[model samples]
Target chain A: MHFSPILLHIPDGFLSTIVSLISWAITIAILSVAVKRTEKLDEKQVPLMGIMAAFIFAAQMINFPVAGGTSGHLLGGVLAAILLGPWAGMLVMTAVIGVQGLLLQDGGLLVMGANILNMGLLTAAIGFGLYKVGDGRKRTLKLGLAGLGAWLSVMAGALTTSLQLWLSGTARLDIVLPAMLGVHAVIGIGETLITVSALAFIFRTRPDLLDPAEGPARGGRGWIFVGAAISLFVLILSPLASSNPDGLERVAGDLGFLAQGKDAPFSILPDYTLPFLGEGAFSTIAAGIIGALVVAILVFFIIQSLRTAKKNA
Target chain B: MHSNIFDRYLHNNSSIHRLAPQVKVVIAILFIFSNALLPDGDWLSFAISWAVILLLNWLARLNLGYTLKRSLIVLPFTLAAITALFSVPGKTLTIWQIGSLELILTDAGLIRFLSIIVRSWLSVQIAILLVATTKFPDLIHALEHLRLPKMLVTVIAFLYRYMSVLTDEVIRLMRARQARSAVLPGRNGGGSLLWRARTAGNMVGQLFLRSYERSDRIYHAMLSRGYSGHLRTLNQHELNINDWLIIALAFLLIAFLQLFAHSIG
Candidate 1:
């Protein structure tokens, strides 16, 4: 429901089915592990997780004017990760992304896995790791590092999205990769400022809101240096990146992805759904069920094998 | 701008509304998956999928105009796909030069772009229809039945319940800020951008504390009532014969269409 002018989610049909399915598998695997890690959710933590998710959701709606009369909203992945642990943060994000897709149609159901992996998994996992790098140091340093982590997290998500699109043959990596990384590099600055200032407020008002180990410190020189470096990088890169906006409109009038799809003889569906209906009344339906069962069993075995492999290692 | 335009579940007695929530979830996913898998430029398949979606909308007694408007949320994504026009290398149909930069239009690229747009538009429509018919909590329930993690489901359920409460709290906080300050921060006429942002950050911090306290109280209340970690809802999702038939028919429809498209190709 929070529609920021800056958008980067890869919608359905943009990625090939194979890429999307693989993303789904990876996402499910990570989330299931996350579920295991957080299995014994303290009775107190459940409501905290819910309310934090809601708070993040509500905070996203309150957009601030950035520059040139345009506005931006918080992604909250790093913020949630800093406030909560990384695993719980990922869960909060997963729920947020799921709700956005299912209720608001912000992203497609077919591509939810990819969306979650890009915006949720990458941002939290990498952002949190970078955040802890400055841990056991100054509080100002920690906040500055949080800002840097938030910024880099957005860039990482953009990079992953570009890679997926390139793999899907939607766009050439040379063109879209730079365009995406450049745009997100600018947007990540906004992410950084919001995250740092919010953390600063918690540092001032409710120090206990943050984890206890990150003690308050005095100097903010590290914060100033990091912030300046980010701005310098964006100022140098964004203007050179302006050509991409017109690239889409200028290149071709209109082309169909399925133009060549119709000429191809092979279809992946038949291999999955056998033509068993030729024999009996319900054979087609039976074949469909059998195919579904086969897929389920295949997935179960794969997961089992993975568990065993992990145990052995 | 915060409105209930999203939770637009209408009160109507229609077959689409009557279907179990899980069935609807399955149907929507299957429909989207099938549409995404459809061959690019396969106009026949696109038309059939659109027709089936429209028929469901009619069955649900939803306003066509509203549904269409809601589906336009996919436009920004379509803009992203437009990049494919320039980046996809193929046989050139037209060539142009912009500032010593060569740009070429390829038949294959254009078709790929259009197919992506069409497929995404269709998928959005199906998704919108699914949400419009079912209650939000019921959708979460369906996800639980589908074996999504219990903790994840519980988090989502609480989010749905508290989203409105927290939104109202934010509205109140903003109103207080506006009343105290001479100019509304961050708008057209306001204080410096950084000052306004700090104020907003403080507001967020305050909201988090308030929500945290409220959750503590809520948890205590639940404990007084012998609350456990798990939340239980009365079982109301009993699948019927019609549900099975609908599932079968939907799968068959998808299979038949894919098979038909293949044979013709």
Candidate 2:
């Protein structure tokens, strides 16, 4: 079986009852908020939102070939979030997913809530959250941020799906977490490329559609906090992944990174932590925080340099 | 071209088709829920649920072979559950030794994996039966009647209405791309993977612009036709005696099935 790990629409029976219920609760809550946020939307915008949902549905059909005869398609969540604001983008995604489940039977009805939560709500939040930082920025900078948002949105979806599977006892955490992330890490690159290109196309043509003033207002810095919380959660869970060394070895072996089931060539954090901090939970978290800070600072400097370069130009 | 295949509803006057959309929707979801709640390796319950699904398919007067084939859509997703075949622990069914590594498959693991496949298959069939028997418009109406959020309902209505239109647009775009992207013998057609992705992305962007423009025209047309903020539908279905009877019967049947399954297990 050609197991494509980026399975977006989760069918039924994979998620346990409790997990499904929780996901449904979370999805419904967020959707209710989205509904309230779009309450004052003009009647004219309704058809536009609907048509946009259809557009996303159609856009997903254009599959580009990847290596080894496998193909990947656009998820369009981040793209929608960029065009529409986060709240409306989320609703559009919900509509698309809902139609997919009810009409096409692409996903299971029972698990549709989790499907929406994973693919619709989370992607919209992350995508719009990160993309909004590019408001009033240079075109390339905005597209770059959108690309980063798109890639992270895919990773977020994969991470949540792995958690759901593990929670349902359908798969082991050690196995599914890495497997899902590893595959999506590559697929996320495709997501980034497609999203950036699509936006670039939009930037060249009908640029008014991307105007923040025309779209919904930004949601402030709330999304950054959400992203931070999610990162922390992932950091907490990273230890569980590294705990099963055998799982990593097997994955490395399958990817042909290691020979004869041997150890990895190198480790970034050496079991996801600094050697000085030792192998405790606290050390792992501290290392993750430090690593995040370093990356953030580097990104800050890069953006600053880009702004200066644009000024000089 | 494949857009028509997505409209799985058969325009038939069978009993299942004649049932109220609300009732069918409720029962379908309940059936899926019951199936999800079934314990792994609960073969008896699985068998009973499969029987119920098959009976429903027969009642709907759908082509059994076609429905079965459509339900196979869930099989590819079963790959997501393949890890369970190796992860679950129990009596060792077999072990494969690759080099110094040992890969073990257990009886419990096999049962768990098979049960997941069966459960997903049965649940998907229930969904198929629901869609096959009810029209998409009626399904939307049923959701509205069931008190789903008004905005969501409206968005779904629009999506269903315009899916085919935009899908055709997409097909045209793809055909255009194909016409332009010709490959020489023993050579790749596209410049590179990135270029191909960019080409597809451009198509998507073009499609979005078209759809957006069409939506503007659609809204104006609706406005001219006296469309207010709220959408009013002609078919307002009330739960009649038969609808109530079917709901009650379904509720009892599902309850009994679950109770019996648990009792035996």
Q: Tell me each candidate's TM-score.
A: 0.80, 0.88
Instruction: Give the worst 10-residue stretch by lDDT in candidate 1 chain A.
Output: A258-267
TM (chain A), candidate 2: 0.77
Candidate 1 per-residue lDDT over residues B13-91, each given as its tens digit: 8989988999999989998889877887788989998999999999999999989998888887665666577555578
Query: Model 1 clash pairs?
Result: A254-B110, A255-B110, A255-B111, A256-B110, A256-B111, A256-B112, A257-B111, A257-B112, A258-B40, A258-B41
The TM-score of the first chain in every model comes to: 0.67, 0.77
* Candidate 2 lDDT over residue span A1-313, tens digit each: 1212258789988998989999999999999988887877777777788889999988888777778887667888899988888888999999999999888887778889999988899888877877767677888678777777776678678878977887687875555666676566577777776787778778878998888776343466677666556545555555435434455445534322111222111224545556787766677677656644544453344345434634775
Measured over the true interface residues after superposition, the C-alpha RMSD of each candidate is 6.5, 4.6
Candidate DockQ values, in order, are 0.25, 0.51
- Cα deviation at A247, candidate 1, in Å, is 21
RMSD of each: 16.1, 5.7
Off by over 4 Å in 2: A1-5, A215-218, A231-313, B1-3, B98-101
Rate residue B61 of model 1 by lDDT.
Answer: 96
Per-prediction TM-score, chain B alone: 0.91, 0.95
Candidate 2 TM-score, C-alpha based: 0.88
Q: Model 2, B1-265: lDDT tens per residue?
A: 6456468888888988888899999998988999988878999889988988888788878899988998898877787787677666678889877554455678888998899999999888888888889999999999999999887898899988888888788778878888887889998767667667667677878888898899999999999999987678898878899898888898998899888878877
